[model samples]
Target: MFTSLYTASAGAIAQQQGLDVTANNAANVSTQGFRPDRASFSDLVHTGVRAGEDAPKTGSGEKLAGTETLYVPAGGLRQTGRKLDYALTDGRQFFAVRTADGIRYTRSGSFAASAATNGRFYLTDAQGGLVLDRQGRTIEVTDEHPARAPGAFTFRNLDGLRKTGDNYFAPTALSGAAATAPDAGLRQGYLEDSGVDLADVMADLIQQERAFQLNTRMVQMSDEVAQTVDNLR
Candidate 1:
């Protein structure tokens, strides 16, 4: 009975996390270059002691393992007709930008022009992070249009990249290093829209709500059963 309560509680917590992730994805459905997130779950540890042949498998409960972002290259290009707008053909690739913390990576090509000390205009993200080039230096452009724009980098392993919020990502220990894909570069005058779909996010929200209710029911049922046993005793 106690095990059942624990299982229900764990499941409830996991469902709550799922709801949070779904809500966030829905909120960013229209955000440029926003990636959708999902909550991942796993069954709790199962214990078994061999009695005669095989012991019955008993599990503690379910748990929220982690959350993952779907970085699929699916969003279509949006023609903003602005010179600062940029987009990448590959979703795995990201433009490098310099933030107060350090250099960060982003997929949102919605850039703004910032005047540098020398009077030359430099590219920056909407939030003012300086855009970077292949050499990891701020990209400077004085001409109306350049033959080649700043290079977007591709990661060896995207799993190791950590989201820093504000549509930026930082490399972690798991990601070996950030490098540029020779073939991938920013497409001028275009921005990539957020890949999240409203329909999908809404469906996921309903599923999570039902799961949460189921878990609550389990907890209630287990408590009632325990109360009955005490009365009989």
Candidate 2:
């Protein structure tokens, strides 16, 4: 009886976690460059049980051991007709300005000239940070280069790119070293759209909600059983 109660409790907790992740994914369905997160669950340790003279059996009690984050990168491209808006074509991630705090990366091509004293143009992700140029320096475009074509951009590998939030990506050791030159062509007058699928997300949300509700009922039933057993004593 106690084992059943534990199993029910675990099921409820795990279902709740699944619902939370689904909700978050649904909320960010339209966020640009947003990678959807999935929850992976593992079963807890099993306790041994004995039935009559038959061989020992394992108790059915189980709980959610833990969860893993599944980062699924799926986004689309959108055209903005803005000169600074850019997006990678082959899963390539753009490098951005780095600070002492840490290096930031992004896929958002929306950029603007920094109003700082230096008067340098800064490439910013959705959250707005400086974008790095081929020279490993912050791109400072002036009116003269305002309409310059993206002819010089390069990268060692595109898949090794890491997420830095706000539709940005940063190169990781897995991504290899930055290319000595920018080889990727920049597409001005366009923006990248989020890869998330709203229909799929909504479906997932509904499934998770149902699962959570089922688990809640299971836990409640288990509690009633436990109470009845206690009263019998």
Winner by lDDT: 1
Give all candidates' CA lDDT scores: 0.85, 0.59
**Per-residue CA lDDT of candidate 2, range 1-233, in tens?**
66666776777777777777677777776665565665666667654475565656554533444443233342567788766766655444454555544665555566665544666665444445556665556665666254243323435765566655555456678777655444453566666566557787788778867866776777788789989989999
The TM-score of predicted model 2 comes to 0.75
Supply every candidate's count of residue pairs whose N, Cα or C atoms clash at under 3 angstroms. 0, 17
TM-score of each: 0.90, 0.75
Off by over 4 Å in 2: 51-74, 144-165, 168-186
Candidate 1 lDDT, 22-120, residue by residue in tens: 999999988999988878899999877455546788788788899887888657889888887888878888888899999899889888778878887
Task: Name model 1 segments beyond 4 Å from true.
Answer: 141-148, 183-185, 231-233
